[model samples]
Target: MLTTRPERWDRVVDAIIVGSGGAALTAATMAHDGGAEVLVLEKASLIGGTTAVSGGVVWLPGNHHMAEVGISDSREDALAYLRRLTCGHEHDPAVLETFVDTAPEVLSYLEANTPLRMQPVANFPDYFFAYDVPGKKSGGRSCEPLPYAVGDEIPEWRDRLVTRGTLMSLGSNTMLAEDFAEPTEELKAELARREAQDIRTKGAALIAMLFKGLLERGVELLLETPVRELIVVDGSVIGVRAEANGQSIFVAARKGVVLACGGYEWNKEMVRAFIGYEVQPLSPPNNVGDGLVMAMEAGAQLANMTSYFGQPAMFDPEISRDGELVPQFEWGRGAPGSLIVNRTGARFANEAMPYNDFPKAFGAYDATQNEFPNEGPGWMIFDQGVRDSTRILSMIPGRPTPDWVPVANSIRDLAALIGLDADTLEATVATFDENASQGRDPLFHRTELGLMAPGAVRPLNQGPFYAVVIWPGALGTNGGPRLDTNGQVRGYRTPVIDGLYAAGNTAASAYAWAYPGGGATIANGMVFGFRAGRHLAAQPARDI
Candidate 1:
């Protein structure tokens, strides 16, 4: 276990932040910069939570850097995109406006105040059905952090900075699977070294840079500190009772308490009860909805409790020693050569869809077939060409892989090995190969037809086929305690609960239907966190 010195006495800060992910850090930084003394509490030994384990990209429309690169986007276009994505969900219009309007400001602030850097990845595509909207630039306005270094500024935080070796990375576009597939051996070697050294890649790296800036600004970090309960006096939240190092510590927040503790992705009971599906989570194991519980207990009204984002994951009943199922993204979905199939041995969705949408599609497939939602594992079928050409991102325990599977001579044999229907599997492969030949996928419209072999017109013609069982997994649960446009929690028949705020995945998302692009979750988190901080900092402590 990790150790930290408990500070003596009873001093109050302007804001108390729980969780150390991008949301928590961003909120803390904004509050501190706004002239409020801020204290950040994390449950893990390190600062970065799930954000550290993610691709460090933020989907910001009309960002300054995008304009600097000659990619012109207007607030109208962004609003159109969001409206198409949300499709009449019960979202606050002000919150949506604030997200787009303040995204560039937040991007600018991070670039100026933090060690994080930004570059636009103009090639990434939005996950929405490509035909639904026009003028939606195929990968127009996403930003990745620059390579940030710890640089001996905070020796105490050296090991605590979630780096790449922890299966995470900070800034740098090359960490993305799309970028990682570069054929250059030198680039591959560099990535390997960076991963070994725990150098944070994408989101993790960006968050680490933010954390470095926070440390430089004399921000205090309290880790392994779980906020046990909220101290609600009268109608406002005043403080938090946290368990730090086996001792109960009452930390007063004069300005407010921002709950960024993330969602209960790993809490199986919560997942089944709230999300109505069985899921293996790809998020950090530590997210358990502590903030949601604390705030709900204090009478915060919850919204959108039934919705959750899902992804495809390879499943192994006993992949982890702790008996927890693991979700593998890079190996199962990101690999270029693989394709997913349902129990009837039919491809269900576009393999290239964003990870979150894959499982949603799977859920649809399950509903169509009258099967248990996400209970029946899907199959990921690939060929030797994929095994030879693609790189498998390391699989964590509990996620299934083909490492133990035997290569089969034909589709029929492969289906037999995996217990799939031989004729159905053959028909599915034939249609896919035919569609690939015509440079079109009629079923799912998967782009990137080149991954399929030329002249291999049917599944029966392929040799040494491979298959792995997959299941519905999630990055994190998206629904939680509902907050107003200002990140203030709403109480029972009350306006705004002052001094109590929530952001990140812990708060209900404004996006109700489709995720627009990559890095959207982090973007939402950072935007709301900053919004909460600024709003709270401007308020009087007594009112809070």
Candidate 2:
């Protein structure tokens, strides 16, 4: 934190927003609408953060759009569901209440202010829908931005998004939560039309719509400008010292600086220090906890430091970003003919569990053995039947196994190739096959056979088996500076940091370890961001 205020500021704005994801942009829009002069600074040359590459679904519990999909949600139901999910977890129940109360309103505001049109993801179930959980909707609580003809509105921003392609295995052709079933001729033609028009769907559409709103409001968004530190005056954050063109630029915030600079998943030091485990991040390389560091320097209290949105990630040599191999997030471990086994060739989890919940099994400790028995280097073992019917990483059905994936004609040979105990592996596969043939998973009691589609329980007896190493990965880290209901950053010594605020992955997640639905991350970040922006806009201008 910068203690001394600069005599002159390079630029002045009522609110200086850091990061350019859903959270940051939402705050910017809200602040701008609330009569504050907002300036958004992005560290990456691109505009969107992980939000751009995500599924772009927004979890709105009592959203108006739910009715369109024949789903009903009440505030009480929403609260009950969240409360049950977050029970015994390190989270603020009040924050969850606040989010439940504020989210629908924020969604309404966003729809009114931005060019975003939302629709329920068709038949998309909440992560815990199958569980006996109250307030869990089988579908419709999570909605996504409709396809937007972005090129028609902002042609200049067409090529500037971080990645038009999503982190999801379902390629760019599919919209939010749309399945990977073979497309009909009409659907293919529609997709072709969208491609020709440079129309974006899902996360891309969400960001483009928000960006369009910012552009319309004349909000000054500077790309490649990273805020280095906060300029504190009398224990309150008043401005920021940012870097641009290899020079330090001091920018004054009359109201406050909102840190929405995403999570620390990419920061190896911070990840090792805080998360205390290996986390393969699915987000952009720029999300290195800049806001968290600044908040820590400002004496901000941290919360939920060890929690993250976890997923089972598979390393695919063909996929990379920023010259680094980007692991493909795999949520289909429970697909028929597939199972993940530890180094001992033992299956350890109900592989059909939610992606966020699945990695918890990876960290399961064997107290007797005094080690993490399930902590990977685990292998996702599958058969040619799966390869011929389902998609795994870049491997499409009917396509030859990618050389990167280890394959063998027998389960014992596959185990040998992947350094697993051949006898144990063969026995595990045999038992699984027998149980699967009986249409039962007595050991794990897995009810769901697939993630996106309903899969039949099939025996993995086909030859040419394949294996890929599975590791703990994440969409992003969801822990950092704690924020109050108003989205004001809480200080260690003070009740609140008067002017400093945080939202998104930069702030501790309100949901804690409970990931309610598909777009919980974006939804949680956006709600607080809206709150922060509204609160920041209402603040009186401070003196330099």
Candidate 3:
């Protein structure tokens, strides 16, 4: 935090929003619409943050659109479900209640004030659908933006927007959240047509819709501009010190500075300090904790620093993103002929569980041994039957296995090659196969085979086994400065930092340790971003 103002202000606005993800952009729109001159600064050259490359679903319980999908939600029901999930965590009930109460309003605002037209993901089950948690519904709390044609609708911004990662695996095909079945010929044709028109779907669509609204409102957005510090005037945050074109630029924010720049997974030191474990992030490479550091420097109190939106991931050496080898999002772990085993070759978690909760099980600690027993280099073991029938990570059925992947003729040989105990590995497989063939997982109590198709469990009895080292990864870190109900950053010395606000992954997560549904991250960020924008806009402008 910079206590002294610059001699000359390079630019001034009513609100300066740091970062350009869904949360930042939502705040920008809200502040701009509230009659504040807003400026958005992005660290990456691309306009969309992690949200652009994500699935772009927004989880909002009690949303009006839930009725369209034959699901009903109430504030009480949403709270009950959230409270149950957060029972043992250090989550704030007030913040959770605020998110539950304000999320529906935020959804309505985005639909009404922006070009985003979201529809309920019909029949898309919540992450905890099979769990015995009360107030949990099978589906309908999640919503996704309708596909938007950025190339046609916003040609000027098309080249600058981030491409959707889902396109990488699906061959650029697009689908609505409701279209879960295998793509038919007609569906394929429609998707091809949409692609030809440069119509973006999922996260890109969500960003494009919000971005379009921002552009129409004449809100200024600067890409490749990263904020270095917050400029404090007296006790209030009055501006930001940013860098653009190799020059330091001081931009004054009359009302406030909203730090929505995302999480710090890419910063190795911060990751080691806060998350005490390795987390291969699946987000864009720009989230390096700029907002987090600045907020800390500004005397902000932190919470939930150890939590993240967890993902069980397998790194593919052949695959790279932004010039680094990123872990492939785990796509094959829950397949019929697959199981995840620890270094001792013992199966640990319910492989069919939601990605967030599934990875948490990997942290199973042994007090007597003084170590995390299920920690990484854990392998996702699969048989030739799965390889012949499913697409495992980057491997397509009938295609030769990538040379980087380890393969062997039997489970024992595979375990030997991966440094696991051959006897334990073989025995584990035998026990799993017997119970799986009987359509019961007595060990993990797994209820589903895979997300792609629900069917009876298939034993991994075939020879020529394969193993991929699975790591405890994350979509993004969800811990940082803690925020109050109004989205204002809390201070150690004061009740609230006068003009400092934060939202999204930069703030301690609203859900605490629980991932409620598919788009909960996006929804929580937007709700608080909306709240911050409105609250900041309503405040009297501070003098620089």
Candidate 4:
């Protein structure tokens, strides 16, 4: 794990991959196995990017393992489901078909060739699984990597991992796809007993195995190497210019270059321009959209530029962890005995909707005869009943309350503190309670979403309430360079750019509008990344 960037430059490799996340590493391993020399460049100091901090679930419909578990899925069904989910968005049909057909193939390849093995999550249901669509499914598409056993004798790799810290200390990844989080008393005791053993779960285990596979395939990885721009020879991308160890280095690509350097959530300008709202990113700061910018400069067309993969988040202005203020995701939205409302103190979308669809409710537009206000934040209000039954974020069950959470004995006081209409808040709570008693939502229908538990429908009429300000937050942007089915980066209104490719967050996502399930991004990232690697290896070597 103690690796350094090479001081040499002007060298050529069969394929140059600009990233070191799951996508980039998958590409590198496949390229090397295809009998081509592969080099991977990561802008961050460490190899694993944001993918390491994610929930580590991969959504692969009709994957080989599902049938073994008695769950049925097919390639045709997956395509139909994707088509229904995407609606009327302009996208390459060939690319969509390739994603569906090759999703399981890539999984099989990784399991057989690499150190990675995934098991289907039986309890995790789809966001739209309740519907009667032709290709609809109930569960088993989501697969999670098994935790890495401790005492493997890799201390250096263990030291390099970055934890999500307070944000995920108690988060629930999934029942079957669960990571090492939300430790109960018994689990805490077990973790303490195994503290020195260095058991890694979730993203840490995923990247470790991928890196091991890459090393076995003889792929060269260079960390702290930020690609500046693509090197074009007569309108065809042939290589990349990057910064390595404080020096400009030009590396030629004899076959192609794959851009998988994540997305632009940390780039304030890009976030402001596309989302039209202030956001606190859930991803690391290194995801500054360098690949996205470079692709645009290379005349690549952008898709889904106005949309992003985001959820609701907020900050505790007074609470700092590790001497810095900790911004927490508003998981309280789905907690029982709670409700979210706008400044007017009226409920908008279903509070229990899928996390990916929650933020979109704030920005929905009607264009026939435009009727909407600007996108804005909301107030998450809850009662002490919730504080008793569930953990409201960092709040301890019986500990003394902190000043960061605005509290009041009455709903009026809580509304006033959060700058909401007290009367409207009272009315909203009263009506919601009446509907909850009967298990009916004439409005948003929280029970129908399938993402929320019945606990989310508990009444909210108890005294002593709490509230917090929450805003739309993105984990990463899904827009970037367009690509064909074969993973070649596409130019605007023209043919594919020679020797240039994109995958992961740097490529415009196929399902631009909807999130298929838990591991939509990673599954697509790996599938297309492997495609880019094999495609680049098959091409004739450049004469540069």
Candidate 5:
């Protein structure tokens, strides 16, 4: 077992936070406000993990902003929607209730305590719709943080943040939370202007705000310092052991430790063991289950190991720039002349479904054919016009099709290129085009959703069709050490491990199947991180 010499502690604080993203930074800020001296440690040299490279939207149903923004959503309505979403998982009712009740508190707290400011995404829809209730189809509850100018904020830490991992931060382009309401030519011009301006939006802005808050709170943060093991004494977690500059250092925590050190996406062994498949990872490479392993060695109970957030992405060997495999999230699947078909050349899913829910369609099993994955490698079929209109991942839109991307002269040729029956492909396109011409998808009813844009429902009748093999690209693993509402990590059999807490992807997700809306993942982390920090700060100081 790994041990720590508390008497030789290098640094001691009331709270020690693991990771340096939204969750850790928020926890540090709150813990400091709660009168706890804090130290944040990040394994990576960069401060933001995937959170710094993502859309920094927070999905909080029934938040106060909903009412203020003219959204008529209630707590009961949010609960009912959640129950509908996770009803099959047999999840603890209290967790959902706590999230629903405390989400507003998390948002209000950030608004009051930090530089983070958010506005409601009045038009954003839940990844899944309200099947049984009215006004639940499209979510009016989602909100995104306002963008921050890099020159205006932390000019020194500019390069230390993770910006290349997300579409919003790609190149010099950045998008505002409110700009998503409508796509106009004027909007394009504005977007171009912002892209040239070096503005930080979405996830970057969130981390910047949180980082600024932490710095202001006097929290000491160490980059490239990984927690190697837990320091346990008499079955109690007293501190964590880490290595920096080839020296073993133990940081003592007087009150508690909040583990927000991300998830196990980069760990292939854990991926196969938990998610039942080997998926191309899209999260930061350092997310290799380090936190989960350390917690388990300390007797923490891990649960919901099978849940993950993923989407279909083509990992083209030639066009894989910066390991950009998944174009589904960036270009999105719903171009006017595109359709995703199974091995049988039949349209199996609503092409307009959000990427998170779209992955579930690939889970179809063909028992009669003995195919374990009936929809394996759903070929995304598009026409030259579609490719010409918009960018598909690393490949620029309106540009000639590259040799790396599979293409053909017609639907039959595309089917043959992708190993599908020509007749079936032709028929599927004929039926789909007929429906799309009328803005109707009678086969799957994709565009019927209130959340899906009408532009996504256009016809695919143009010539010179193209196809590409795509598989589910995992964003990250969601399962990890179990925690109570207070974010206190629980032991295998014990109710709670006293000085232990977890938040973000380091812990099992409360809702796992389908994404609630945009920024749901970050919002979950923020809410839980808020709880963990408050709970830890409320505790009396303990002697190291």
Candidate 6:
């Protein structure tokens, strides 16, 4: 039998937060800072959840950091982006407006009270729709947390620190393959050295930085503890019943219990029922919608169940265990220098569109052919130039370059490898290559269409061309319990569920169609988490 920690019960916190991802941690920090005793319960042995494994950038438009750098942004522009993206997507306007208006204040609070710092991801464009929007910084607004301060200032969390690529590093930029072009031998050597030294990179570094701050503030984290149900008394949420160390621990919350546990990305039954497809998930394994189930049990109404945020993710079915397939994030099939095609040997939507748009478009493609959603495995094709110029991170074993199988010297050969019609594949490649040569992809209208960079370019004439099968994978499901402006759960015949709140992927997102930025999910979590914490902390103790 596994040795479990002795069961210890406590009911003294001002708030009890489920899931220690960005949302939960942010709320815990806010409640603790507001003089409320906060307890964070995480089902995973590690605390960060999906946030720890993600690209640690948050999209905060009109933020204080933007002003610090002399870039002026307004609420109007932000709202316009929201309107353009959501476009009749069942989002509450009030909540959307609040997210835009109060973004700066949330940034201010974090800078003032926490170790988290912010910086803009320069030159990156908003997925696509905001290309012509005024006052929109090309890359608009994305921020990263600064490195953690070393020493015993924060305890125990050091061991729990999450690192990228299973190592530790500091001040490393989360650049895509394009970002590493012309990587000097010195830089490559340095990266290897860092990898050898076991430095934490990207999201891992950011989570560790935030965890350090939470620890310094005396916040208590209960890992491997799962909240089984919410404690509601007389139409108001009072606390939670959790499974901790093989015992039922009932923790009372004088303020509120914030649910930031992620969506049901890994729940196969829920995904097939709700999303209408079988998709490999890109989020952490623990995101099984425990919070959503608990909230629904307490009468929370859900929204956007038919929709999901999707990405063009690399798929390897053979490596799957217990019906769960691993998803590759760094190797984007539709990044700058590549294009995606369906099994019918026809190019579908713009591969360069945001990941969310890709899967939705794929679903549309499947619908057009009267096939099951996500039925046709997608293909990514690129030239040797792309191979040399881009940093394509693949999992092929013992190869200096990222390995892409199913390659051929001719379209017919490639088609045979990918199981596509020979003539159709030849015609498709001919048209694509013609358009690429002339800087015009008429079919998909890929923006900024151009030839592969000089160094990264390899002629398609090379024998043995490459292809990889892809599927509609997701970071997480977007649909969940509907939340009001103040992060309160909504129900029929009720204005809002008092003392019940949600944040992160558990709450329905404002961006239902287009992804606003790379770190928008984390931003939503932090923003709503802060709002829910303050709103609950300000409530009278009797509201509990």
How much is 14 displaced in model 1, in angstroms? Answer: 2.4
lDDT of 3 by residue, 415-516 (tens): 889899999999999999999988878787775532322334568988799998898888888998889998999999998898899999999998887888
- Residues 25-129 of candidate 1 have per-residue lDDT tens digits of 999899998888899988898778988867778888888887666778888988888877677684577778878888889888888888878787646655553
**lDDT assessment of candidate 5:** 0.76
Which lDDT values do the candidates have, in the order given?
A: 0.72, 0.86, 0.85, 0.76, 0.76, 0.70
Please provide, for model 4 over 189-263, each residue's C-alpha lDDT reduced to its tens digit, 9 standing for 90 to 100: 655544446555566567777887887777778888898888876777778888888988888888889999998
The candidate, 2 or 4, that scores higher on TM-score is: 2
Comparing 1 with 6 on lDDT, the higher-scoring candidate is 1
lDDT of 6 by residue, 1-544 (tens): 0112224336667888888888888888877877788888989888688888776778888888776556777899888877776775747788788889878888788887777766765555455433444444555477665434333334445566565522111235333321335677876776666455444445665676666668888888888898888877777777888888898887878788899999888888988888777676788789987887877877888887766667656755444658865676536454444666777777776666566767766566344656743354778776554565444444332355443356567678888887888897778777777666666667765644211111111124444456777778778787888888778888765777767899988878766644776678888888889888888778777533
For all predicted structures, in order, the TM-scores are 0.86, 0.96, 0.96, 0.91, 0.89, 0.86
Q: Rank the candidates by TM-score, best first.
A: 3, 2, 4, 5, 6, 1
| lDDT of model 1, residue 237 | 79
Question: What's the true lDDT of residue 453 in model 1?
Answer: 15
lDDT of 2 at 278: 74
Off by over 4 Å in 1: 1-11, 125-129, 165-200, 315-325, 330-338, 365-375, 392-403, 433-439, 447-460
Give the range of the ten consecutive residues with the poorest summed lDDT in model 6.
Answer: 450-459
Name model 5 segments beyond 4 Å from true: 1-7, 129-140, 163-165, 168-173, 178-199, 316-332, 367-370, 421-443, 450-460
Per residue, candidate 2 scores C-alpha lDDT tens digits across 80-110 of 8888878847456777889999989988888
Candidate with maximal lDDT: 2
RMSD of each: 5.2, 1.9, 1.9, 4.1, 3.2, 5.0
- True-vs-predicted CA distance for residue 37, candidate 5, Å: 1.5
